[model samples]
Target: MSAGAVADWLGVACLVAGGLLSLAAGIGVLRFPDVLDRMHAATKPQVLGVLLMLAGVALRLRTTSDIGMIVLVAVFQLTTAPVAAQMIGRAAYRSGRVDRSLLDVDELAEER
Candidate 1:
């Protein structure tokens, strides 16, 4: 019933929700049919999950330094995840591992 206890509960809730979202993203990685679909899985939820977890940690930690690190983590995830995704996508495109059935457009490969 205390305010501090209520805040702690909220932080725990955020952490749990974040963990669950990351788990869902992992499931999508397994369940999706093709590279693109799976990449979609890898991209959105991965960022969301990172954001959520960072927020959760910041809330729970409740310190200036923890918050700075959380912001850094969020920035790192936002920047790096897409670059990695692009690399994987390009590799898949070059190797013809792409599932064309699912692709309406691919601008990566040099067209003859």
Candidate 2:
């Protein structure tokens, strides 16, 4: 009923949601049929899951002192995850690990 109680509940919910997203990412990586799909699984949901958990921690702590660290972590995760995924996906494609049939566009192929 109190504001503190609401904040606590919200923080817990965010953590749970993040955990579920992490689980989904793991399952997707394992079950996906291709390297590109697996890279997608490893990056997309994983980034959001980390950000959500960081947000939950921030909310639960209710302080400004650690905000910088949390923001740094989130920014680092957001910036690196997609780039890493793209590089890995490109490597998979170039190495002939990705299934050609699943791709709709092949601009890399066109370039070569």
Best by TM-score: 2
Runs in model 2 with CA error above 4 Å? none
**Taking the tens digit of each residue's C-alpha lDDT, what string does model 2 give over 13-107?**
99999999999999999999889878989998988899889888887888787878899999999999989988998888889998887789877
lDDT of each: 0.84, 0.88
Provide TM-scores for the models.
0.86, 0.93
Query: For model 1, where is the 10-residue window of minimal lDDT?
Result: 101-110
Candidate 2 Cα RMSD after full superposition onto the native fold (Å): 1.5
Q: Lowest summed-lDDT stretch of 10 residues in model 2?
A: 103-112
Model 1 steric clash pairs: none
Q: What is the C-alpha RMSD of each candidate to the true structure, in Å?
A: 1.9, 1.5
* Model 2 clashing residue pairs (backbone): none
lDDT of 1: 0.84
